[model samples]
Target: MKKLLAAALTGAAMLATPAMAQADEGKIQFKLLGTYVMPDGEITSVNTDIVGLPAGTQTTASDNFVPTLAIEYFVSPEFSIETICCMTQHDVDAVSGLTGAELVSDGKLIPATFTAKYHLNAGDVKPYVGAGATYFWWVDAEPGADTIPLGVTRTTLSDEFGFVVQAGVDIALGDGGMGVALDAKRYFVGTTARWYAGDTLAIETEHDLDPWVLSAGVSYRF
Candidate 1:
């Protein structure tokens, strides 16, 4: 983690040293984009006695494809603050690692994020990098009727705070006011999730909700 931060700061300093011209200072940019989220980890269950499963039961969440938006305010041609938002619903299915049986057939996850980026604008091509935090409004899972009868009923994820890193490039579509952008963000937020059967607590454990979000779309500068 320390190494990563050091690398980012070094890169930013190198980009900032050229005394580049600032043509787009104070402009607001908006992007309408299609985003795809690929989650690359699992959620594990610890107290399996409540669910009748063994220890270390890992569950994998599904990927998401949706439309999203980003609003940015350029502090200067070399820097900007942006917020990315979309209300997305994801279905989560939990498969027992040991038995390979599908446990929770139904579940959902929702999230939103904000960022501050530094842009290295070199004429028609703009390359940028950023770091920020993410706030998850909702994350939960519920088992099917068959699983409820087996003592493992539902799972709920606590709201979490995580760090985010982003890197992307913007290509001029025509002139200064329009462009096409491509970016990717990695979120490092993993929190403990809980599983329950009615009023009975089933399992409590941590899971990596860390996801890599890739986006591409059109941006307009005003």
Candidate 2:
């Protein structure tokens, strides 16, 4: 009887090993995604309009699609910390006052972000909600065609800090550590646009840069 009990205990241990290993494998997840960035570049207020913008001056930022990489570390079964990396380019155009005119050209930005997420598991699917902070890093920009014609030789956007709210889901493909991911985030941010003619500041405007970021792709956990 003693020998039989020992054999049963050993078999139970063997049965549990694979489950333990699988749990450990999901501590880190890496995702490759295609992201859509849409921003509202409306002029909230014009601080300095030396170039004489009209009364109904307004702007809109062009939407962009870019490749994004996300990395997540599971703090527990239901909690994770995640960060994403990507660079998106955009152009700001006048939609009202000087209709169809470009005001800022080829502005490149990197949204450096971090979030703490709470995940809920249901069968093979996990849904999550997160809130985070972001810093809009303006890497490069130039005066638009219309602005350049207006003695605008340089243009710069101020880097600012903002907050973001996110929601997403992960669908497991199989018992393997691969899955599909879909995510959406809303950002609340603002920036100051300054146009320069030689060494003189020609125009300075404040803009609301609230953007909707959407992403869909595959994820792998190891």
The numbered model that scores best in TM-score is 2
* Residue lDDT tens for model 2, 100-120: 999999999999999999998
Writing each residue's lDDT as its tens digit, candidate 1 over 1-222 gives: 999999999999888765433443237989999999887447643534544555545666668788988999987777889998876555445565444454444445556788999988687798999999888766455664445566765667678888899999987776557889899999988756666767777767667878898999999887
Candidate 1 RMSD to the correct structure: 10.7
The model with the greatest lDDT is: 2
- Least accurate 10 contiguous residues by lDDT in model 2: 17-26
Worst 10 residues of 1 by lDDT: 17-26
**Deviating ranges (above 4 Å) for candidate 1:** 1-26, 44-48, 95-107, 144-146, 151-153
- Those runs of model 2 whose alpha carbons end farther than 4 Å from true positions after fitting are 1-22
TM-score of every model? 0.79, 0.91
